[model samples]
Target: MQQSKFPKYIFDWFGGLVLLIGYIIGSVIVGFVGVAGKFIFRLDFMQKPWFLMLSNAIVFCLVIAAFDFLIVRPKTGKKLNFNFSPTNFYTYLLIFPMMLGMMFIGEFFTAQIPTTGPFFGDYYEFFENLMSGLTDDPVLMVITAVIMAPIFEEIIFRGIIQKGLMNKGVEPWKAILFSSLLFGLIHGNPWQFVGATLLGGVLGLVYYKTKSLLLPMLLHGFNNLCSTLLVTYTKNESFAQAFKIPEWEILIIGIVLFSLFCYLFMKKNKVHYSDI
Candidate 1:
């Protein structure tokens, strides 16, 4: 970890700036490629809402990893660890169900938050329209939604940026909060932003506890996959009607249960935010 020559807060600011720029540059490049591919090939696959998202995620991971190895690790004198374990595998048992439940809960608040305009509505509408144009391939959806997203998103957010913040002497809460906030903000959705932030924070805490990027990666991917499944189901009138219930109530239950489980897990694991 490279010690900041500047004040502590300045480290976050500078780190945040670097991360933000890196994210934007990578996103723009990926976006350009996606749009150009769609235009040149007259292919709707490139335009599919999830295609670019998953593709961008993959690109972002690769960029972050390359940058970490070539720039960050060398500068900071830290080695990147990409290990996984059974403990990490078991962690998903808790994360996946709760995240899925949270998605249902989040839908109830959909109208309360800003889901319209430049970042929110337009972003989703863009993807929704693109998805509408593409052929629904379950295999493709699983590959893109379940596998690619978890691997890449985890690498960038949990592995690189979060690790950078922690190494810079940032407090755990602050590190988690800021990293999660950036994660949400970069998504450019006001409505989903809050939920993503909360989830990101939780995932950060998990990462901090387990010291494993794979845990958060699985949680993030599971959350996304659940959302994708829900959207798929809702698209079918019969499926939507059959499962229709007071989702808000379920969300409330999920929140409570999640809180309790998290508390227990943290306590049992004897995990707290300590210097990484």
Candidate 2:
């Protein structure tokens, strides 16, 4: 890659800022929509789980489209790849376990950190309420979590942000690391940050290797599906606890299986992307 005249941190910072602004704007728009729905249509849109999910999907899609049109397309002169290639289907499947294992490892480490007090506790309650709302409408939750979230997130984080950085002469590792960090920060909480960063790094690697947005989207969707199901069914139990096994055991098993799969995958496939 040719060296860019601009600093790499500019792209990193801008990517995160754009997402933050987009989310704030999206929330305000949704709030207005809810107000209008309540007064004009005699419906409490905020109380409707499906409408909330649809609103979130629309917001994310619009943000992604804006970034692509205003920034990515003009600069790169190429639309982001969204194709579903079967060339790495088996390898892609392995990414699920890899991500899950990473999440377990992250959670284990995060649990060791001392509590940050009432703020963190309140955040947990907020998350629980959010999950409860989703669980109230299982179909909507599936649509939003499994489908919409993955598509929008991958397009923005991997397709637009990460790829754009690389095009501007950012080193592949730096691009992946900063992009993953941005992904984690976007989740807006420490617990989520740790898990998201780990998963995002893996997703970034997959995207860099395959040059396909579809793979990460599918993997992300699968991860979300599993998480949503666990939250819905397990109620009070964490994923590790729900299995009726010790946390350490789960972590050990996850590590061993993930390592084996990664070894097999790396042995079979050579990265084709020169930039990486």
Candidate 3:
């Protein structure tokens, strides 16, 4: 990789600032829409919370994309070249165990994790209510949770922020790790942050290795879909009551397989892209 001449911290700070501004703007827009919808339509979103959430997500993505393309890109002098290659499927299979490992870590820390900003009980209740509303329409839930969130989130984080960090002379691993941590923190709950950050790191590695944002986006989508399916399945009495097999042995086997796959993938891919 070619070394960047600019001071990396400058870009990191700037990127974080941009993200903060974008989020504040996006959240304000969502609040406006929610208020407008309730006043005009006389519906409080219990009827179609999926639509409400999807509307918010879509607006947020568009705001970020526009900011990235119109303002950020012009400032940085770069074009949005989205590379969504299909050859990176195997990479995600390798990411599965890494995600599971993070879940285990989250479980371990669940007890010790201090509640910040909000009490644990209230936060969980809020999350449950939000999720229940989102899940009321399974199709829309899948669309929002699995497809839209992954695509937009990956585009913003891995493609924009990570790339920005690399452009400013930061090392790839540091950029990836910090970006992942930011990714987790943005989720607004520490419990989810543990797994989200770990998964974010894995996604970062995928983007670094392939130099393709699409790969990480797809993997993220799959991860979200798997979680959605697990939640959906567990909601069913028959499925929940079914004899659940303890997957410790399978998890162990998965660790070995994932390790081997990571080794092979890294070993086979040697060419690195020049930093933007």
Which window of 10 residues has the lowest lDDT sum in candidate 3?
236-245
Candidate 3: segments with Cα more than 4 A from true spot: 1-11, 45-47, 69-71, 88-118, 236-254, 269-276
Where does model 2 exceed 4 Å of error?
1-25, 76-83, 113-117, 271-276
Q: Where does candidate 1 stray beyond 4 Å?
A: 1-58, 77-79, 88-93, 97-101, 114-127, 130-137, 236-242, 270-276
Per-residue lDDT over 1-276 for candidate 1, one digit per residue giving the tens place of the 0 to 100 score: 864331112234545556556667777777777778778987765656566556667566656655555556666566555444336344556656556555545555553565477776787677566555322665666666678867876766766677767767778888788878877886665666766777887788788877766678878877777666755766631222336656556567667767766765676654333232
Please, what are the lDDT tens digits per residue for candidate 2 over residues 1-276? 674332222245665566667777787888899999999999999898878887888688667655555455566565434444545457766667777776667656656544546777778777667668877777877888888899888877887788778867989888899889989998877777877898898889878877767778987897788777876788642567678777787778768866876676567666443322
Better by lDDT, candidate 3 or 2: 2
Q: What is the TM-score of each candidate against the true structure?
A: 0.73, 0.84, 0.78
| TM-score of predicted structure 1 | 0.73
Error of 2 at 154 (Å): 0.8
Best by TM-score: 2
Error of 1 at 35 (Å): 7.9
lDDT, candidate 1, at 268: 63
Best-to-worst order by lDDT is: 2, 3, 1
